[model samples]
Target: MIFKYRKGDELIEQTVVKPYDSVFGGQFDSWNVGKKLSNLTTCSNFFVDIISPSSPDDAPPLATLHFPVYTDQNAHCHVDYLRQFFKIADFCTSGDACKEKIWSTSYPDPKSDIFVGYDEDTQTLI
Candidate 1:
């Protein structure tokens, strides 16, 4: 998996080969892994890039799962960015939406305090 952070034109990408099981209780799935990455207390511009083995070519990301870690205010800039990238409906959950969807959607763990934005282009959420 590739972990990334972007602001304006500056994009920092990191290739993670080993899993930090001790830090995140060994959760390896995308959602849980994303949750762990989202907990970087000082980070607000975090994103997970799932590299497709079949398509190693550099193309625009078709899907994105945004984890916004704003404690004071539940706001994220990636929503508009993903909207323009995927050309899909914006699905955002915050505060209450976070609490409800986590359980209803069978998320591995609850995400009550974070803001989540899912790409609708891949039709994953539907």
Candidate 2:
């Protein structure tokens, strides 16, 4: 789904796909409908929430990425933020453990890599 936020207007655009389980509720077997008006751009600052039916006790975790259009430094900052947000430690120094196995195997000298770290006490990504 896509939503755009705009100035002055309070509504936002929203699109939903069918044949998928509804996160809110109700058995929507057919294509449902809804609408709103807003001025937000395609790529703008916004918040998103994703939920699952199985666990209802806690709010779902969220990941956000912000990229500036005109600066390489900003781009690098976003990348590094993502790396740190995912709790990846020392991607530059780590060897095979930091590389994505599927990507490394599929591509010829792929430039990007991924790493995952966990908090032992909570068994969650830190």
Report the number of clashing residue pairs per model.
0, 5
**Candidate 2 residue lDDT tens string, 35-126:** 22132223233333322334454644232223222233235456544554466533333445536443344333523331355668878654
For 1-126, candidate 1 gives per-residue lDDT tens digits of 444444223554444435556865763543343544344434355455655444556765545555444432333544544554466433446665654553444344534433454557864432
Tell me the lDDT of model 1 at 22. Answer: 89
Q: Could you tell me the lDDT of residue 98 within candidate 2? A: 39
C-alpha TM-score for every candidate: 0.29, 0.25
- Give the number of the best model, judged by TM-score: 1
Best by lDDT: 1
